[model samples]
Target: MKLARATFTPGVLGGPGFFGGMFELPGGYLKPVLVSSCDGVGTKLKIASVMGKHDTVGMDIVNHSVDDILTCGAAPLFFLDYIAMGKLDSALVADIVKGLSTACQEVGCALIGGETAEMPGLYHGKDYDLAGFIVGIVEKDRIVNGLTIKPGDAVLGLPSSGLHTNGYSLARRVLGETPEALSKVYPGFDRSIGEVLLAPHVSYFKTLQPVMSDVKGLAHITGGGFTDNIPRSLPEGVSVRINTGTWDVPPVFELIQSLGQVAPEEMFRVFNMGIGMTVFVDPSHVSTMLAAMPQARVIGEVTAEAGRKVEIV
Candidate 1:
């Protein structure tokens, strides 16, 4: 209760109720829409349990949910989490909550409330699952839904921090389940496989804040990777042409592909490969967008191609 109260601002969220909590948003908008998203850490939690690393996964769920809402040009207002485990461990719960608080503070979102379940039969051993729900607000006219995307609009790729909470199931299978397999030193990467795979998912709220108005579309590269996620923001009759070699593919992806003997096309379809987010910008605003995000690169462009929604060259 204290932790939840600490995350709320006085005017935004209402006082607690007997049955449930109250959330109050100040009213004064020409057009306001509430955008909500729910996401989980997936099989990444298995690796976290194996390694006994609980702190970063909290941020993973929060960041992942924030990015989903961000795709609709919304600013996060509050976040709620769900934690289920075989048995409740106070220390583990606190560590996870600490991470949630830290991430929510960074993104300026409130950790309003959450549920923790202790189900000995449902979950086995120390295993637990995490899910996050976030709500944000966006003005109607300010929403970027790729309707403005044109054939010549530039596609900018935002670098990802490793897998970014996706592809862990395939990665684990390829790397093996034992600690020795995870600890083995792979060529090209200075850190162990565990370290690289555990990198926190980057939140684009801060990076895209300045250029949100300039973006025609935004895609949060999650489960679908480039093939599926990018098309979500693309309008009808338009498609994306991505130049795969534009940016250096991270070594972790290379190792996964090599060891798993996964097809090149499948790699782009499964993992983020390298780019975590994709933004469509008008040719005129490309320079300004680039200036705001120096790390972004021109990985592709919008096209008027028929049938195909995304193409990787």
Candidate 2:
């Protein structure tokens, strides 16, 4: 509690005296709608625990939650975290907080508050769980709900750093669960499996902030991969046709597939394959959007399809 109060200070966050701290928003929004999302690091935490790495997991939760609200064109205001463990280790807790503060500062979000619980029976020795909740604001008129998305709109993809806090359950099974196995370098990857697996989730806020107005829809590729997530942003009667040959599939994904003998179709469904976030925009704005995000690729296009939401070819 002291840490939260000191970190979130007065003026930036609501001062002490209420059950929850207050967040004051500066005027400018015509029809401000508060967007909130909560997400956890999932089984990826198991990898962290095994590796004794807790810092980046904080970023994993924050970035995951941020992207969730970012889909609606919202700017994050504040973030709260929940840490539950069997025992409280000051050093471990501090490391986690350091990561949380770093990510929150990077994205201009306040680490307003958090909860840390020490439950012996609930969690095993030295084990912990991490979750984050974020609140952001977007003008009602400016929300990117995909309702305006039409056929022929271009779908641009933003590349991911690595797994980005998803697919660890299967990754571990494919790569092997032993610590030595995780530390071993794979055929194509320069870094160990642990390093690639623990890469911090990338926040698209900075890249997308300038082009939010031009974007008709946004999808953050996480657990569901392209198949499930892209559909979330599609309107009725429209579907996205992705050209599988448009972008290079990251080597790590290829390594996982070959090692696990995972089928091609399941690879796209379970993993990002390469792209992390997808942006749907007017065909004419493709160059401008690409200029704003040079790393993004013109991966696909939206088409008139009665029932399908996404098609990878």
Candidate 3:
């Protein structure tokens, strides 16, 4: 229903082989500003190929991109995907599309267009890459650029649903990429290692809607984890001071830390360590936001001091 209304003509044009996607949005007096972001699923695809699970990676790309634009206070409108592989299989495409459609519907974003290619010279058997481009809209006045972020503001960390599409290369190097190795279950984890590693990334768009006004900035912790991502959402003179023991670091990270013999600081730099998303919220609204969203907790604060972007204790 959401997609059909925004599409220029449902199923008539747009998607692979078409020149482009046609979308219609009814603009009002609010003067909606468009926000867009593009991202790839990264080396996580290797794990998916080994496990023969193509669905979740599709979700990973969409959710990852959605969260990216959400930092700008935009609500996702539609999404487009690009998939390239060596051999194209109907079953494989179906699984991947299923995941994309599932994620798009969940967030009310239209999965109106996408491309799938078979490149024998470039990719090998089931090995492929996935990328997503998302466009969202927000009122210009409502943009959260972190300019308003300052000292005394509370930093809240949202629990991640496992790795959330990052640190996979190092994880692969540590956890072993073979089918048998992934199938091995370690102590404390009831499921196979592959399942934990393959878990799909979470979407915070809808969940953060209610408290959007109170949030001054948001950092989608990816690629560089807390160290790199948090700074992107901070102003010049302000930095984050995270209370390390505030939230439970998921066991999967501990497993990687132990098995890979990774140093503590490197783990925080390379992975989320538990928090998938961080919010710089107004102190006055902190309690209300926390009460509204039980899964989130006070993880740190904004410091007036400059220099280091993230200070962990």
Candidate 4:
């Protein structure tokens, strides 16, 4: 695990002690555009609080924000974070920053600076909230915004780390948050429920960089799951048909559904079910995309449908 420090980036002018981080765009790119995205760990932090684990949620905030901007084919440059707590717990703050630095190194992003606040009234004891902001660069000609997506374009599925920082409020509602409940190892699960739910969000920046040209559009399946998210990348008069059977849904999702009796559609609407990020490509590039990324699955196709944004069949 590496820390985001000046050692990794001496070119960074003002880092920890300055009012802001200063960066110059690295040489050798043409018409580069900066893409930025921000996100929080959400109620998923509640699980981390209950479990007494602080670091993974830090990774969650960075990875989640990084992936959001990655949809437009951006490479992370620098990241800043906001961690708010009731009291300034030095050990806990250090643990959280440790996770953020490790994730920054993993994505080749600089952890420039951040803010930590201790508000006794706003936040309860030991409870904290985490959010991250990331800025990335991409060539103007290389932005993948799905404008070229057509009816026959093939869809590719990228698997998710369980939960991946979304739908936690509902997840906590269905799955008890008590110490005993979090520790329960369901029949099909090897790790306890808490461990599965707290798995850090996956960052697609490194994995998809090489194959980005093979894709015409990208969608990061986050808060809205398929129904609300897939459409953001789609052109009008066209919708996606997701082949749910194409990949295996993780067991934790099944546990949440079974315990809560959540409807099938609601489950898909809330959690990712399985797929995290989706890649759209010309039908001709299906083989090329899958060959380049073996872990990806051909899970759906675009159709000439107007009313619905996504159809899970």
Candidate 5:
């Protein structure tokens, strides 16, 4: 297993120091429970592929996998990645590994190993894709599967780091890849198009882990945005009512909305907009969770309805 390497990004927040440090399995634990999740970076890779950058893709995979299991109240133990490409460039591969190593260290998980398949004729030359699998553990009683999400439960929304690995296909259509276009800067952007598109995926393991027990349901706002993913963690006769003006939508999303002529409903359906993860928590403990995670805001409340839905007020 030749783990992919990443470009050495030197800083306290770069590699091992990026996260709080490695975490050990809980000692004196009864019935060690294992949880796992597998996800790819989705067509967001198209932007990276067009930009000829590969380092951050590895971090994207790591963060996304970590969030998946964190929703189930699992602490990430280790991560494995799969990178397939038409050809292998040592520099590109190194960049991927470096990002993975940095992200793994940050989240206190081990980047034990991974695979790099150099399959010619499979992927187009100069094109690659990433998928990751993560394993984590928790006590049997600590899993958060939404069974406890009641009608009065509060929904807290965590701000995202831009797009975070979803809705790129449409994003690309709205914002294409010409040298001039990629080099130009938006009004509020201090970075160029490539820079924004390559921004690392946000990891929530440390942010959400401590409060998972109090969380009745955890929703990772991904592909279907809040509209689709939130319902998966919801129980029957319950839905979420989202307050639309609770947080400022990131400008990048606004760019997509304006350029794509995307309806508010479709925008929520495709992108995180700004909020990445929504947590359904007890009304009483909502303040505690919010205090622990200052970035999280009360976006909505759970409700009993005919079907699962997200009403964006």
Candidate 6:
């Protein structure tokens, strides 16, 4: 098999070691329940590459991909990645793979296979892009699409670690390039801008795994922040009202807001603000679910409306 012929040792390569080991279809035959999602690190890679920190990006890609399919309530089975750079460096690639392998292993998913490209001119030297494909499976009856989400459901929010792979384009513009500028630690931050911006995208698979089946819908707050991402999982006629002060905002967000003069509403629209993933659950299970997932807070509640609306307060 292709996995066997890989130049890296069986375990050294992501595919053979991480994802390939844990996932198996119910039957011996090839046909099986499958769910897949694809995503990239977005402009966050620019920060990593600029800082010469190629290590955490693999985590960003895997976590981002994992969150994409997790919206479907299916646990990840395996992941495949694509890495393209103007030139290839074994050390850099290894750092990326190490992060990928660590994430895949923690989530109990396989890092199945991928393609790496060393283009001549398409990419500027040392500048690269990463994308990942993830596959998951759920029973015919167990899939958790938002079809069941109804008005009056409780919206539980999982805290984000910062921007989490979104809004970096604007972020870079607001905060100019320079290690000294970036290295100046924001209040409450022991690290610098580079560290916060490069913070590995948080993975919710483990935290939400136990309660996945009980929730009606799940939303991964990504590029569009709560305004855009939350609606993707809402049923017709249902909207969400979020309390802005429900959780303490991470200081990094405050710095961005203060520096960019980012409006309160605009901040919520552009960044995770604080909440990363939101789960809509039935009233009956809300208490139990919140108790189980301590990292979550009752940020909002679902309601019937003409269209999906996200309220900051």
Q: What is the TM-score of each candidate against the true structure?
A: 0.94, 0.96, 0.94, 0.95, 0.90, 0.90
Model 1 reaches what TM-score against the true structure? 0.94
lDDT of each: 0.86, 0.86, 0.87, 0.86, 0.82, 0.80
Clash numbers, per candidate? 0, 0, 0, 0, 11, 4
- Please rank every candidate by TM-score, starting with the best: 2, 4, 1, 3, 6, 5
Residue 246 displacement in candidate 3 (angstroms): 0.6
lDDT of 6 by residue, 156-234 (tens): 8898889999988878888866667667777777988888899888999898888888988888999889889888888
Q: Kindly state the number of residue pairs that clash in model 1.
A: 0
User: lDDT, candidate 5, residue 105?
Assistant: 88
When summed lDDT is taken over every stretch of 10 residues in candidate 3, the lowest stretch is: 1-10
Q: How much does candidate 3 score in TM-score?
A: 0.94
* Model 1 lDDT per residue over 172-274, tens place: 9999757778777787788878777788898999999888988889999999789999888888888899998899898999999998999998999999989
| TM-score, structure 4 vs. true | 0.95
- Candidate 3: segments with Cα more than 4 A from true spot: 1-19
- The 10-residue segment of model 2 with minimum total lDDT is 1-10
> Which candidate, 3 or 4, has the higher TM-score?
4
**Candidate 4 lDDT by residue in tens digits, 227-269:** 8899999988898999888999999999999999999999989
Is candidate 1 or 6 superior in lDDT? 1
Give the Å error, residue 26, model 4: 1.4
Error of 6 at 130 (Å): 0.8
